[model samples]
Target: MKNINKNRLFIASCLALITTAMTFAIRARLETVFGPEGIGLTLEQIGYAFAPAFFGFTIAMIIGGPLVDLLGIKKITWMAFLTHAVGIVLTLLADSMTSLFIATLFIGIGNGFVEAALNPMVASMYPEQKTKMLNRFHVWFPGGIVIGAILGWLIMDVLGLSWQVMVGALFIPLVIYGVLFFGQKIPVTERVQLGISNQKMFSSVLKPLFLFMVACMFLTAASELGTTQRIESLLKESVAKPLLVLAFINGIMALGRLFAGQVVHKLSPSGMLLYSAIFTFIGLWLLTVTSGGMTFVAAAVFAVGVTFFWPTMLGFVAEYLPETGALGLSIMGGAGMFSVSIVLPVMGNLMDNASAAEALRTMSILPAILIVAFFGLHMYMKKRQKTFEV
Candidate 1:
């Protein structure tokens, strides 16, 4: 404990998350830049181009998760830095759909590495406050999106700067986090420190409850990311400044996550997931019918719903299923991203053949599924707690 710099490590982790979140904002803006109106690529093509971001994340998390133990978190973290640097430069140079796809792939891998490394890192560092601290740590995800969205608006929309400038903004956080992590003493993961063998970790992930959560991860991630990733296209005709709306939604999310401790205490992780699904379903359906100023209200509800979804899901695994270790967290994260990767193209096709409103309604179905799943989870957990009590 004397050697561990919890404050510095937590700050560095937040910086890494901010870097990851900026990519989402930049990619959202890029949708318009490379869309049929701009570069003449169809929405489906843009979806394909963006596919790498999620799947690449899946690959990195799956690969890096196991490696975090063998290679060490420090090594995996630096790996993320290297990949993010390469991805940013490639994105700046990308013009065609093929080039964009490759660049996004690299960024997605980098983003995956960030989560693969940092989520476990934070969980390890704060064992007593896993859910609360992880939620605080995740504030940067939406917080960074808010920064990136505003920067994109100011640089491209208000100031008329090149999109390249917006891409360049990623370098600032990238450099800061690198400096913070350098020469710092990194800790072994909680699993390794507790002497949990690799076999135990792997087997834990195969358990019925763990597998169930992974299944739900797919739907939860798609409901949140699939919708937000295509916010520009979905809200194009319905809103004035979609990016601002994106910013507004993430802004609320950032604030909500910052104070997640109170909520997690009251609702429990399973309860939170159940409630999030409820709000998300309502929000998505509302967006289908709303326009103009009312769009922000609907987005607000959606943001509140998804605010706890990602980090809370990870936190639940880290807390209740601690035996699954880094690999478990990685598999959960990888599953979510992989699902988004699949849904992105389908959503793009929906946009092409149907309306954006129709796409929103379709995305709503994901959370609708989660509602039933999480309700089952809540009941299962309650019954298990009762068994333990007896």
Candidate 2:
């Protein structure tokens, strides 16, 4: 194999990071626009609007995963760029709930393709460092949230700029990433490169165990992001500035993901996941029961809990279900976002009728359910290995 271009790979990784951050930034702002007092949309309405991103992501992943193998990365990369551009343009024109929803759907689809194209691309480029590199690569998800949150504060809150200006900020990175991918030699999908048959990959992805994991991933993602994205509205009664709180939580998450290699090296993904759930439980409980800066602390703890959840889940699938290939990873990503899409509206409904505390308390059930699910997954994997050996 020819030597992998570290510089190009690094550039690609950065673009992926920026795209993730941009998506979340827009997500964060959506609550602001569609929240109770902003444009007079209810919590449920905001949640429904946000649903498009996850559903679009799921659509892209299920559709694009195989295409990445057949059509190659260059075509997928261009698709991501075009979809993102069109989505953002639609979002900027949004005036009502209907327009906002449509725009978000397009943007969500674009965001999903970004992951569908880039994740396996990165995994293939740095084959030897699958876990670490992927974790490091995923640093941008939380990292971008932090950037988005801070930008939210700077443009919308502190500088008193129009929210439209903040939405427009995404165009900068979209153009840059597009430029970076231009003329770049895209790497082969990991499954193809490993010489795995498409049938094997399909079977591995659709296996009962894998499907069960996908179910758990969806709930975990919904529980994690659905709650965090609403931190501003949920804590509006407590925090003087909700966006600042969002920034603080994401700051810790970004730092944690950047250092995830050290954490993963010390603990198995299952162990890390269990630990994450515990922290998430404690954090959510505290957020629900407390007030003031303590709420921020709770948010930080919750961030730490989920810090490893997204990338680690991918790493787990990659390590344990390698035959599932890019399709599996795509499904994992899609399922996660899809789960969030479903949960966002539920959270919105809860907040609409019940108190913010009630909504959070309701969301807490997700992690509790996952605690049991992870243990089951661990046992299943162990039993599978035993069966394989016999």
Go through the candidates in order and give each one's C-alpha lDDT: 0.94, 0.81
Query: Tens digit of lDDT per residue, candidate 2, span 1-390?
Result: 375565776676677567756677657766877676788887788888778888988998888888888898778778888988998899889988899888888887787788888888878877777777788888787777777888877888789998888888888878888877777667788898889998899889878868987987887788778877777778888778777777777778778888888997888777778788878878888888877878778888888888888888888888778888889989999999888888888877887788889988888888888888887766766677789999
Clashing pairs for predicted structure model 2, backbone only: none
Task: Output the worst ten-in-a-row residue range by lDDT, candidate 2.
Answer: 1-10
Query: 1-390, model 1: which lDDT tens digit per residue?
Result: 569798998999999999999999989998999998888899999999999999999999999999999999999999999999999999999999999999999999999999999899999988999999999999999999999999999999999999999999999999999999999999889999899998898889999989999999999999999998999999999998899999999999999999999998898899999999999999999999999999999999999999999989999999899999999999999999999999999999999999898888889888989999999999988998899999
RMSD from true fold, candidate 2: 1.9
Candidate 1's error at 45, in angstroms? 0.3
Q: lDDT at 316 for candidate 1?
A: 91
Q: List the candidates' TM-scores in order.
A: 0.99, 0.95
Candidate 2, overall lDDT?
0.81
**Among all candidates shown, the one with the greatest TM-score:** 1
